[model samples]
Target: MNASLLLSITPYFPRPISSRRQCPLTVRRNARLQSPLCLASSSAPIATRETEIELENRKFELLRAVTDIQRGLTATPDQRSSIEESLVGVETFDAGKPIELDLLDGTWRLQYTSAPDVLILFQSAATLPFFEVDQIFQKFECRDQSGQGVVRNVVRWSIPRLLEEQEGATLIVSAKFSVVSVRNIYLEFEEIAIQNINISEELQALIAPALLPRSFFSLQILQFIRSFKAQLPVRSSQRQSVGGLYYLSYLDKNMLLGRAVGGGGVFVFTRAQPFI
Candidate 1:
């Protein structure tokens, strides 16, 4: 029998070592065992190894399924169902206590999401001629050794009429996240701001040649844009009712899965370069 199968039926408690003579053939024939006579001690490691392999296979399938979904903007209903199924499979083997894992501290690139707000942005970018959306990232920085951290969702977008192709705007949604449970966190919205407007080289070169050098133009524009930040007000609270619940369904060295509580939506992310 397979080790994993043996583990399922094996006796939880170790049976006392017995000589064949101690267990008479007539007595053994009259008794029926609820579980296998074998002990489960050796099967534990085999079961764990099997689970790890299954998780890896599930993750690979999920990544492949979402490869062409364009962050879920173009995913059909059938495709969505398939992806959801795969997500559940991977989630079954989630880290027991993701908040306690140091692997959670890093920037993660958004590979796919079913959140309405994010999908709306993708739809808008596809339909609007002037507005375009780029990469999205979520950065986490834990602190105070309390399993608390700041989570920032960064969105890069551009307006073709106002900025060059390479120039873009960054929208940062800042929130404070606290571990409310082993796999759940409470996110309190803190602020939303648009910052870091990158001016393309072509535009800087063209405008700078006429009046000042490129470096001077770049510096002044950056200074002007730096003033465009604001501190938004937020209600203070640590209660789950005060904010939204984010369930970390899966997390590993390379990928992560975040599902909004109450079936709001799901987000899939892969580890990326740290945020500056």
Candidate 2:
């Protein structure tokens, strides 16, 4: 990504997540790992069949409210507070470590986020008529039972005059995450990559299609646009790097709510396909 695009998109996780404090919340739980120390094996009563139904209904209501808010981009102060309260209410039933839940091992489409960094992109999309922000997705892939995983944050966008809607490129941020506690996860970003460029046919024919697949360069075309495909390091120093903390406040098979450790704001997501 070039400096301008990076300036607009890089803050998706510019700062490391801090795992300092824990918020009071709860949430309904289902699915369990086969371990003696796992919360699922506890003696506490699990959600009754009736309670499970109620939780599902409540999730549907919250989903509808979030949709109306346009993912928090257009939410009023009162509306944002109301949504936050509803999220907390639903989080009350959350039990056990969500990172250990099998339901979390998949892609979750970002439905809402109050994070200032992400909100900036939403604001930019509204003001810049030519620039468009498409779906934002987070995919988690765990390698073992150690509660460690890889998290990829994908932002799909396009410039209307330069690229087609479906042919827009993606800005991917790759990070390594580990379950720090019952509801907390620490993310250490590895690198950032900008890829999957699709130029219009007219432009492709004008330029060599061979190099267009990955990158393009020519003396004939001095270039009006700046394009890049490279992986850049995120950490400046490994020793002093503490990383960022993501608090998984509430999670279930369908719905998820997470709060950034240092007032980065809340994030709401729903399970989605494995790939974009």
- For candidate 1, the lDDT comes to 0.80
Once superposed on the true structure, which residue ranges of model 1 sit more than 4 Å away at CA? 1-47, 95-98, 164-167, 205-207, 210-242
Name the top TM-score candidate: 1
* Candidate 2 runs further than 4 Å off: 1-47, 96-98, 205-228, 236-242
TM for every model, in the order presented, reads 0.74, 0.72
In the range 37-126, model 2's lDDT, one tens digit per residue, is 544433223334446766777787777778866678999998788788778778877856455546677899999999998999889988
Location of the lowest summed lDDT over 10 successive residues in candidate 2: 25-34
- Deviation of model 1 at 187, angstroms: 0.4
> What are the clashing pairs of model 1?
none
